[model samples]
Target: MTAARLISVNVGQPRDVELNGEIKQTAIFKDPVPGRVKVVDHHVDGDRQADQVNHAGVHKAVYAYAREDLDFWAAELGREIEDGFVGENLTITGYDVSHAVVGERWRVGGVEFEVAQPRIPCWKLGVRAGDKSMTRRFELALRPGAYLRVVAEGEVGAGDTVEVLSRPEHGFTVADASRIFHRDRAEAARLLAVDELAPPLKQWARKRLGLELEEEGG
Candidate 1:
């Protein structure tokens, strides 16, 4: 596969927002930052997640979005959606990491990351898009961006080459996970065997397949 390049490094902090007459904190608003930036096990140096329980963790450390996907949404939405506008910490060009195999390993500058899962859309996503239906539309679009776990903490910058260091043999892609979750419910079983599949997905699969109790019994 052709190499992909990092288009931008974005960061934002959680802030209070009024949505539906209720005050909520969201870190979904991100903007591109120039030059190199530090990356850690939990997040990019200055980035944060509003929901610590679900959105914050080593498994969901860095969120990545494809510039191609961004353009697609821009054309579909009939508006210019800039890089990092979708709350992705890394905006990439060329290869859309959306197609990356589950547990695939990639290197950006000195940072190492493992493709852990897709960025499952939520209410914050809709808020970021300024459209209440964006969360659902994003699911149906099947362009779910990638969430990467930090394997080796370091620094990354715009224009860095994204090197595919290794790929998990399981063959499940980030987009595949999104599709299975939203449209192909039956494929949940296939994900159960993938050790690198996201934890929430694994749990959902076990429950859907009625194997949760069986696994617990083992």
Candidate 2:
């Protein structure tokens, strides 16, 4: 059995959104996304003015390792490692976290979360990277990362171990879902049926597949 490794976990408060000279709450996995709980707005240079929505709620987003990356304004930023990412409420390294398909389930500590959707890179990441092109880099990787829908309803902290509890029957990994959803909608249709997609993802899939899921009879 392949074991998923817990690489690093990070949580931080928005730099610009300060009150009385005090930092707000550190962002968490289930934190409310302004209008939505699962959705999060990202900024590159710690600038609140340059934020955008690329990754939808409950979507897992991944950032790759790049050495040439440098901060545009280093004075205002916090400690960042070469291969580490800061936006995600939770960070993971091993266990092919990015390749997890929708509908697949995993457990972290006592909390259970399921892969909801493949993340779509937004402008906020570009700001974070100090280069708009970095957004494309993340998108090109296709392993942008993943979002987990809480199943057990529990609080998760850094250093928690994640365990794979179930994998989808179709075997449609996150990478596959990203390509199929954009390049080939028909194939995506098949995946949505089996994948545990988030609301936005499910909506996208239903429209692309032209297969409306009938509600179960009461």
Candidate 3:
């Protein structure tokens, strides 16, 4: 298979905006950055996450969306969706990010990242796109992007080569994680099998499988 490559490096700061008569703070609006940017252990430099409770952590240091997926959405939405429009830190090409397995390691430029989980579509996605139905559409499409944990922090830029260094044996793909996240109980076993999944995701899978409470009390 051809090597995946970074098509764009995007970043954004948190800002407040009005959504459905409520003032909400979000970092969903991102723009592509020029030149190389520092990839920190926790996040990309100049990037911010407004909802720390749900985003921007060591397990989700960088979010990546495939250019092909963007193209599909562009055709479906009847408008050109630019890179970073979906709040991704990296717009990538030549990889089926939605199908990437948890624990898969990717070396890009001088940095290394591990696939952590699939990005769960939130209301902010709809709010940013100016369509309340966008979140539902995104869910139905099942093209949710991937979030990566920084394994080795360094600098990266657009056009950087991305090579997969390893893949987990558990066979739990990001799409499987996304399905479990959306309450598809059938994927619980596969979700639980992935040891590299973030803690919150593991807890969620356990809860869905009726194991969390049992395990916690023990």
Candidate 4:
């Protein structure tokens, strides 16, 4: 396999954006930052999540998107896709973020991270894209990037190599998790057995399997 490397490291501060008729706080407009940046408790030193309810937490800490995926979208959108265009903290290349195993561990520079889950586009994504239909477009794109949890906080920067430390024996990937959450009960049943699956996704799978209610879901 070709080595994977960090293309860019990005972060953003919350900004007021006009959505529909009201102003809303969003941090989806991330820009690449030069030099090394520390990975703190749950995010990069200069990054902050605007909405905590659905974004930014231990399990959804560092978002990573593949540069190849961005290239695909750029061609589709008839424009150049910038690094961190979709709010990802790390823009990577060579490794497929969407296919990353859910429990896989990787090290970039001095930081260690675990694959946590796949991104689920929201209205904030549309706001960032400047298109009301972007959320739906992204969902259909099937290139949903992966979110990672920090295992060992340290610093990272552009050109840093992404090194895989270990991986679960099971083949449960971010794409499978995304599919289960979106619409596949059978797949959910199979993947729920993977002990290393992210807890939030496990809860969601249980709810999908009728073992819990939506209110009890993650």
Q: What lDDT does each candidate get?
A: 0.90, 0.50, 0.88, 0.89
Cα lDDT tens digits, model 2, 16-99, are 333345543322221212211221332111212212243322343322111122122132244453324426545454456567
Lowest-sum lDDT 10-residue window in model 3: 209-218
List runs of model 1 lying over 4 Å from the truth.
Answer: 213-218
Per-candidate RMSD, Å = 3.1, 10.0, 2.7, 1.8
lDDT of 3 by residue, 1-218 (tens): 77799999999999998887999999999999998899985799899999988988988899999999999989988999999988999999999998998899999888999999888888999988888899988887888888999999999999999899999787788888887777586777776677898887888777778885755554
> Best lDDT goes to which candidate?
1
Model 3 RMSD vs true structure: 2.7
lDDT of 4 by residue, 89-171 (tens): 99999999999998899999999999988998899988987888888888777788999999999999999999999998887
Q: Which runs of model 3 end up more than 4 angstroms from their true locations?
A: 213-218
Backbone-clash count (model 3): 0
- RMSD value for candidate 2: 10.0
TM-score of model 4 relative to the true fold? Answer: 0.94
Residue 67, model 3: lDDT of: 95
**Model 3: lDDT of residue 12:** 93
Score every model by TM-score: 0.94, 0.62, 0.94, 0.94
